[model samples]
Structures are given as structure tokens and as C-alpha cells.
Target: MTAPTPDTASLTSWVGDAVLAPSVHNAQPWLFRYERASGTLTLRADPARTMPHADPSGRGLHLGCGAALFNLRVAAADEGWEARVAARPDPADPALLARVSFVPGPDRDTLADLRPAVPRRHTSREPFGDEPVEEALLDGLRGAALAEGARLDFADDWRVRELLSALWDAGHAEELAPEVRAEIARWTAGVDDTATEGIPSYALGPRRYDGRAPVRDFPGAQRERDTAAVYESRPCLAVLGTHRDRPEDWLLAGQAMQRVLLQATLDGLSTSLSSQALEWPELRWLVRDPRSETAYPQIVIRVGYGPEIPATPRRPVDSVLTVE
Candidate 1:
């Protein structure tokens, strides 16, 4: 007998969950097209949302789309469908990221377990408690990344210091670049409750007054009412990486990134991501620990206990998804 296929409504609902995936600056640079006839959902990169200055090579764009693809898989599993995904299905079409075909199947408990965290996982920019994360939980996070064919290494004290210094240098470089500043301003400008995308003022957290927090300073992110607080003195930082650096590797890293983040959320940890150093080619190399085997540092993750922050805005499903 032929397997059951997901309807348009089901696909649309899955896409709803998919958009919640984190992106660079919350740009959400992805598009989804669902074909009812074939029960397939196509993930595409939206060129219009590309950040030329900060992400000229489109690595960030691919990572964001990859994250959205991972969410779709989780959504499918939660809804009792198996999502058969093909990354870079079309060799000729660079914009086409992945194609997922859904069929009725038993729920994947592993992925369904993370569905609850989909909505709850937001970047916490506030100060995190000094309490250390348990070793067991940290091990689970490592497993989560490995399961997705990526590696997550917790930075040692010396490496953490080097990463912070690289970030400081990258941040200073970003401030001096007019084009990069303009891009930051474009996304963060006049963000309000009604806004569908970009980092809102309330979610930007306060400017760093006196801490080595690896938070990206969005232009004009702070308001007069906000006050800076001391972030965790010793942040629990991890480097998510892949063995090879390629478009496929980026997608894999992104899936691993979301899986790690969601698992952290379920483990009662506040999390934030920093790509400031990775945005700079030289600093990106500097941030990687020479002693470690993992290559191509994709993202720097901050994991600890902190206050829950509000979710960043996302474009409505209708705005980013199309059904046929």
C-alpha cells in the first residue's frame, strides 16, 4: 500500500514551526514552498535578505536556512510524519537549499521531545548566573551535536580568553566598517511589537558596561531606560564545528546548532550565540583552538542559567511560505 502524504494544511503548520529557527540577526533568510501533489516542501534561500557586508559569501544565509530545515524535521516528527530530507537537491539551483518529502510514520520520539522547546528557545541576552552547568548535561549537549554529524567542544579557560579577544577585535572592526554598520542599522531600526522580523529593542538587552560577554552589539540597540548588568564573569562557551568547510558542512553545522540549543533549553539552560568573530576571516581562524581537531568553527554558544528573554520577531508564515 502507498504511504499517506501530508496535506497543505499540515505542511503550512510545519513551516510555522520551522520559521522559529534562529538566524543571523533574526534575518530569517529562508523561503518555503509546499507542493501538495508530491507532499514535498522546498527550502530556498531568499537572496533579498542576504547581508552583503557581514556575510558576503552567504555562509550565514545557508546556516540560517539549514536551521529552518531542521525545525521542519522536528515539526514533522511531532506531527507523526517522517521527513525525508535532501540537502542541496538541485546542483544547478544554488538558491534551493533542501527538499523534504513527508510520509505518515510513527513519531520520532527523539525529535518530538524537542518540539516543546521550539517556541521556548529564545536567545537570552541578560546576565547569566555564575553557577556552573552540570557535566552530565554538557555531555548530553555534545551527543546532540554528534548525532547531527557535527562536533561541539566546550572551550577551556585559555581558549575562552583567546575567543573573547578575537571577538573584541572583530567587534572593533565591525564598528569601523561603514557598510557593516549600515547593515546592522537596517535590521535593528525601529523594531516594535508589530514588527515581523529583526531584533527588537526589548530583545537587544542592555549595552555591555563591564563584562567580557560575547554578545554582539547591535547598533542603537540600547535605549535610555535600559541599564547594563554584569554578565557571567566566566561564561560557559562552546565551539560548534564541522570537519570540512563547505555549503553542505554549513547546513550540517546549522542542524547541529539548533539541536544543541533545543537540548540546552530542555535541560534548563539559557543560551545565546555569537558569530562576531566568525564574521571576520582572520579572527575566525584566530578563535579556533589550535590544539583542537575540530575545524571550521561555525558558531560560539553561551550556555548558562539566566533570565528568559523575549523572542525575536519573525515574518508571518504567509510572508515566507508558499503553497501550491
Candidate 2:
């Protein structure tokens, strides 16, 4: 069924689709409020969803909400409406992440095609095929990030590889700390049916000893069996960054991330993200390209052709949306 045409109902439907956007550890850290009288949709971050230990400054929260905002825009376009978005419009209210107003515009089916991938796009932690991504497809993904005010840097040099590895080493070291481990444990719910969010045991991949590469192990604490198999080599790594390292910059990066991911989905690519390296302050600077000026790295996205993985579960729409 199509989304309702009335602004309120339409936005409600759009928000439902938007929530399907990925978040760190499936936190789903967002709230949507639709003003029927004004026809404005406001996206807010739920402070409770903030990962205080891993994401102390709420940067990841902004990224997650920003991804949801991007999906909302695409969903709006698919429904034949223009999404006029303002990121962090009010300085006084930090939680007011973005405001989207619907306007009549030319019909664009590009986003309509993306609608199908919204449900299909997933974080595939399994091994990808050795087949490299086409240069043209990579260009499309780059352009998608640029359009959202973010830059995509493909790591190809040995120095860059060393830097990323060093950062990952440092970040992983930090994660191993007793205090940090306790904090993460608090947020990460054990295999319980009542839990609505956080990474589940089923999503965890295997731990392989490949000195050249590393993958985040979600079920490391629970000793769950790894359902994912290993590929021959690591997939192409692309880092998303912004000129500035502010809250607004992070929001932009999040939107760009989802755009690139959805575009990858359209190109029949499987993807996963590795932000563990960028989570730590000391290691964050290491992830940035030395040649590129001071741009903060937001995420490390791994992309390549591979088998479609299972989608993660999300909370119901009624749980995240407020009608008033």
C-alpha cells in the first residue's frame, strides 16, 4: 500500500520507513514529531539511546538520526514530494536534529527505486566475493556522499592501511578496559526476548586471525557460534569524513553514509561498517588521511559484492513516533 497523501499521515508513513535505517548497535536513537498544521516533520535524538561510554559526545547518536533523516527524504521523494531539510536548525535546542518540510516538486523515480532497497539493505558482516566493485559504481557512491556534504576517501595506500590498523588496535585496547567493558555490557542486553535493541547473538560474525584486517565481534561476551563465513580477502574500505568535526558535521556524515549504503544496495553490493577505530579520540586522528586537512573521519564502510544477509529487527513505529 502507498503512503497516505495527507501531510500528517504521509509523514507518519515516511517516518515508519525511515526508522528502518541502520544505527550503531541497533540503538534506533531517534524520535519523529509531525506537525499537521504546519506540515513540518522534526527529527530528534532520544538522549536515552545515547551510548555514553562508546559515544560520550553523542556523535554516533547524531549519525544514526541523520541516517534516519536521509531515509525520510528518500521516502518523501518516492511519494512525489520534495524534502526541504534544515540540519540542526536551532542552536538553542541541540536535540532538534533536523526539520523537513514537504513541498511539491517534479516527480523523481530515482528515490522510488531506492524504496525497495530500504528493507533489503543490511549490515552484512559475512565474507564478500573477491570481485572488486566497479569503478563506475564507486564513483556513484562517492557522488552520493558528496551530495550530502561529506567526502568519501577510498584507502589504497600502505601508509593509510597502517594508520587504520593502528587506530583499530588502540580502540580495541580501550574497549578491553574493565570500566569500558562494564559500560558496554550495561547497554548490550544478553540474549533475552524482551530486549528490543542492541546487537543480537545471531548478527555476530566469526573471529579470524587475519593480521591485515579486523572485524567487530558483537557476541564476543556470550561465546555465540559465528554464523558468517570468511572470504578470501578484505573488501574495499571507504572512509566518510567531513571538513569540520562538529555535531552538524556528524549529522551530515550519517546522512551521507546511508545514501552511499542505499546506492550500494541498488548496485547489488553487500556492506558492513567498522567504526570501532574511529570511536576513540586518540585513534580517530590516525584514521584521517594525513594529506587531507583536518577532516574528521566519521565511519569506515566496507563494501563489495556478496550474499544478502539477514536483516536486523527494529522496534515498532508506534514506539518511536509521537502523533502530537
What ranges in model 1 sit over 4 Å off? none
> What is the C-alpha lDDT profile of model 2 across 198-302, one tens digit per residue?
666555555544423446654234525634455636458878889998888888899999999999998899888877777788777777777754378898888
TM-score per candidate: 0.97, 0.90
Candidate 1: global Cα-lDDT? 0.87
Candidate 2: lDDT over CA atoms?
0.77
TM-score of decoy 2? 0.90
> Which residue ranges in model 2 land beyond 4 Å of their true spot?
1-6, 157-160, 187-189, 192-195, 209-211, 223-229
Clashing pairs in 2: none
Scored against the true structure, residue 8 in model 2 reaches a CA lDDT of 63
